[model samples]
Target: MRAWRFHEPGNIANLVLEEVDTPPLNIGEALVRLECAALNPADRYLVQGQYPRAGAPPFTPGRDGAGTVVEVGPDSRFTPGDKVCLLGGGLTGVSLPGTLAEYAPLPEAWLAPIPDAWTFEQAATTLTSLTAWRALEICGGLQSNDTVLVTGASGGVGVAAVFLAKALGARIVALSRSAEKRKNLIALGADAAIDTESSTLEKEVRAAAGDQPISLVIENLGGPYLEKSVRMVAPEGRIMVIGLLADLTATVTIGLLIHKNIRIQGMSVNNFKAKEAQDAWTKIVDLYNANHHRPPISQVFPFAQVQEAFAHLQAGPMGKVLVRCSA
Candidate 1:
């Protein structure tokens, strides 16, 4: 099999594609022939040494993908030819060899069966959608009556949150620097879209809140965006910090933190237990099955252009960027 590997992390420039032996299918794991793999910011970060190297090199970086199961370990629930969505096995790309290769062995727990008749590209969205779902539903305890705010609203998780929040009947206030993306967010069912580039972040957020306060904030940009979220969220509001597209460190107001009874929780899909992941995936599947919420794909690059794919993601894509893995 052919795979991408980086000997010592520096940047995407270090990534090299070459022939490697296929990973062995171990107990409780299944061998999947990948059709598509999703590129994420974390994958880019790993290449640049900004993300953790779970183990030694040569590191294989990837997490989300869609594929067909060709073999299963003893007593596996999935059978041969099962159309499956790869949730990237938590941090498989960092911890072990991952889905960027044509063939991957994924744990049974991380592989979810694709919804009937869904495209591989759609199935490739499972990881990002589930991250958004867990952040909103589980950590934030979102309610239909709540007015939600999504930061970095054009991002992969942000887009999913918009669609999911809309499906669950929440009024959304989306924030983006791009006017065009703001328009797209409005069309995707956000009640309001604010500009992140504005100097008056607090004022813009408050105005977007209007009469109904922002009950929940899905904070994707950690530093300045999170600080703004803390100041603007309604009293007793919940903030789920799931992404660090901006710098990881944020100096939040302790006064507001104490006075408002605000609950801020940091969430990562990589830390999910098997049951948490399974339950969240089930909910995602059910939500998409309802035929209202669909994950958006902005681009699909052939496997040969893997470097270009990461470059495009770093340049900032409006939605999911995919790599076609089948050769």
Candidate 2:
């Protein structure tokens, strides 16, 4: 088998294609022949040794993908030729050999059957949507009619958050730096789109929400947004932190917690309860089937051009970038 491997994690340049033996299937695991792999910011962070959850070096790098099951171990529900997509902790390429290769062994529990309406490229994006589902349903405790604010609303998780929140009947206020990208947010069902680069972000949000204070804040950027989120949330409101694209460090007003009874939480897609994961997976598929959610695909690179795909991911495209792993 041919797969991309990192001898030692330092930078993207360390990634190289090499011939390797097929990974043996463990109990409750299945061997998947990958058709499409999604490149995420975590992949870049893992290669740079910046992600906290990634494992030691000498592993393949990819978090999510869709493929056909080539073989299934004992006690697994999957069968040969079953179409599935992956979820869970082994998603980090540094810890386990992921979908960046032609084939990889994935836990049977982490694999979900792809919906009929979705292509492999579309199924490759399921993990991000699942993360959004967990953040809103479990971490943020979002309710219908609640006013929700999403930072970095143009990115993959951000866009998914906007769509999922809207489908749940929440009033969404989306924040993005680009005016053009804000249009994408509005199209994704955000009631109001605020330009984050604008000096009057706080005022704009206040005006958008009117009498309603923000009940939930879905923050994908950590730095400045984290600090501002503390001030904007309503009494007893929840703030879910999911990404760290901006600055990792945040300075928050401690008084806000005491005065408003706010709750701030950090969410990792890798850490999800079995029932919660199943519910989220079902919801996302239902939403997709209803035409309520559409995961954007900005670029598709061939497997041989893996380096170019990583470079493009670092360049910060508005939508998901994918690698077609098989012929």
Q: In terms of TM-score, which candidate is strongest?
A: 1
The stretch of ten residues in a row with the least summed lDDT in candidate 2 is 87-96
Residue 249's lDDT in candidate 2: 88
> Whole-model lDDT for model 1 versus the true structure?
0.85
lDDT of 1 by residue, 1-327 (tens): 998888887878898888899989888899999999999888877877887646467877788889999999889999999999877537677686777889988888888888786899988977778888888887889899999999988988899998888888899999888889999999988889988888887787788778999999999899877888998899999999988888879899899999999999998877777777878877777887795566888799999899999888777678798999998
- List the candidates' TM-scores in order: 0.95, 0.94
Clash pairs, candidate 1, are 63-88
- Total residue pair clashes for candidate 1: 1
Each prediction's RMSD over C-alphas, in Å, is 1.5, 1.8
Please list the residue runs of candidate 1 whose C-alpha ends up more than 4 Å from where it truly belongs after superposition. Answer: none
lDDT of 2: 0.83
Name the regions of candidate 2 deviating beyond 4 angstroms. 88-94
